[model samples]
Target: MSNATQTDRWTDSPRARWLAVAVYAVAMAWVESAVVLYLRTLTQRLDPATTTPLPPLERVTEAELVREAATLIMLGAVGWLAGRDRRTRAGYGLLAFGLWDIFYYVFLKPLTSWPRSLLDWDVLFLLPLPWWGPVAAPVSVALLMVLWGSLVTQLPPQRLQRSPPGLVWVLTALGVVLALYVFMADAIRVAPQGRQALQNLLPTRFNWLLFGCAWLLMATPVLHLLIQLTRRQPAQPTASQPE
Candidate 1:
């Protein structure tokens, strides 16, 4: 077979598809773990007393960005492979995110035993809110991603209905807003705090509620789609109708 045909055959095969995803995930985890280790070392080297109050936007070194970018490029390749089939791409994306997430924690255990428990604090992401919580927080999100992926991939093609593009845009916007609220919560609380207080002013109870509500909202689209897929259908009319 030609090289292109051989490549196509491998990607189309179930075993190859899964193996590719697993390898991609492992590479991503390794890169992330290494970057984190380097960052911790950098942090230790810095003089905490003399460092500026605000973190630098380019704190991550050029080498680190190159490594991270390579990992992301690999992830995008896996996404492209997984998304080859429209029927199952959503499922692939969901599984890709979840597995990548869970394995990141798994690989980090040996590199640095930081999170001893599920409640250990973590910076989930860097964008707006920097998600903070125990290890369980992202794990929960990963599980949800898996659920959404399974639902998307398993549904029959006949049952799949696209929501209005406007509705999709609305949901996407709401999701971003909710995510920001959850992430910047600490910053929001600090706005009213006294000098030298590095803590968030928001009550723990409120934070928990907000987090729970945000998660539920994220799950809504997937849940609705799943219901549509699983619902029993009525029999179709016969060709021999009464005259």
Candidate 2:
């Protein structure tokens, strides 16, 4: 084949899946950051660490919350399309989420000097409730997701044949719930008073120990998978070979 044809084939190959996902994630993150920039510009809540981080409820309408939900759906759809099976689909989803999250900060730093440091706090999500955490928190999780997702997606098929048990998933789900609780603790505390109270609240402390435990628990399946892959033995010869 000609060099050009070879290049094209390589670009279309399975090995290039990560590249495609990364490109799409970067673009999505850029667009999302731009949207946030516009919103901050409009609301004048540019610095997330200020006393009043979130805009008044009037300024942040239901539409904005809906848009966030829509973004998640879109991310999930991209993963579904990129992966060949459920596990790989989940890997792609994590890959997309991780890249989008990391690049959200990357694209934001240039536009808004917010998140001055990794320790800077911000409002994370608003589905069941508003999640609050330092920039380092989600970034740390995203990095782990990238690592796990890469392993899941790039490992040889034979290495991935050993599926994680149901107990592992249960532990993972518990870990997720614990982590969410940690993030939403402040918001939940103020929720009874209403949106204003919740928005006005600033998190004073983060339970790092609990978060660490949760993070390690969440990593169980990935670690187990890796162990299995490592312990996997080569198939033995079906017949004796002549010396």
Candidate 3:
């Protein structure tokens, strides 16, 4: 079938949906960065590398944790609403998350001149524990999320573009575990002491070697997609677009 015919055959096209998702994610990121800016300004700890957690330590920490969880749900809900199936729903979630993260930093640039470089260390998350890593790590992972998500959503569901195998998922899970471990090792070590110990973490350096391995493993599905794409037959020319 012609490319136009194939695209038109779909009852609900992901291309149009992708645009909506992208706009939503970008706006969400702006709000997230603004919120962080306010919190940091309140704490007088605007530096990304600072060891300071939010003030009124216990209450603020609880609030921040809840906010982070709420953000995830909001992102996932948009994905759930946009997709036709479970797989595509997951794709939209990942895509929205990746866009939100990258743009969070983008929006932060003007609000605060923090993260002078990609290598700047950042306190990435605070759910079960404090997750710390360089800005580059999450950005790289976000790029991977975007790649895999686009493939899952935009690629035609045909033999030419099949779902990744079980092994790909296993490797991806392994990668996620490794990355989380790397991000939370400091906090984990201090857990024996108490919350006070975790609150005092500075995180002097990041384990790039381990994170690199994790990133490669996390890229399993993308690698599989590339292999499938290389074996695909060349695309037929389509009708020209209007001027």
Which predicted model would earn the best lDDT?
3
Question: Over the stretch 1-243, how does candidate 2's per-residue lDDT look in tens digits?
Answer: 899999998876556887898889999999989998998888787776667777676646577889899989988888788888888888888989999999999989999988789988878887778888998999988887887888888887777665788988899999999999999998888999997887678887899999999898888877878787779588876987899
For each candidate in turn, the TM-score is 0.67, 0.91, 0.89
- Compared with the true structure, all predictions reach lDDT values of 0.60, 0.85, 0.87
Ranking by lDDT: 3, 2, 1
Residue 205 local lDDT, model 2: 88
Name the lDDT value of residue 213 in candidate 1.
68
Kindly list the per-residue Cα lDDT of model 3 for residues 1-243, writing each as its tens digit: 898887775635788888889899999999999999998888898885665453446788888999999999999999999888888898998999999999999999889998888888888999889899889999999999888888888888763344568998999999999999999998898889977777777788788999999999999988988888779577788999999
Better of 2 and 3 by TM-score: 2
Best by TM-score: 2
User: For candidate 1, lDDT tens digit of each residue in 20-87?
Assistant: 66567667777777667667556652212222322343545345446555655666566667665754
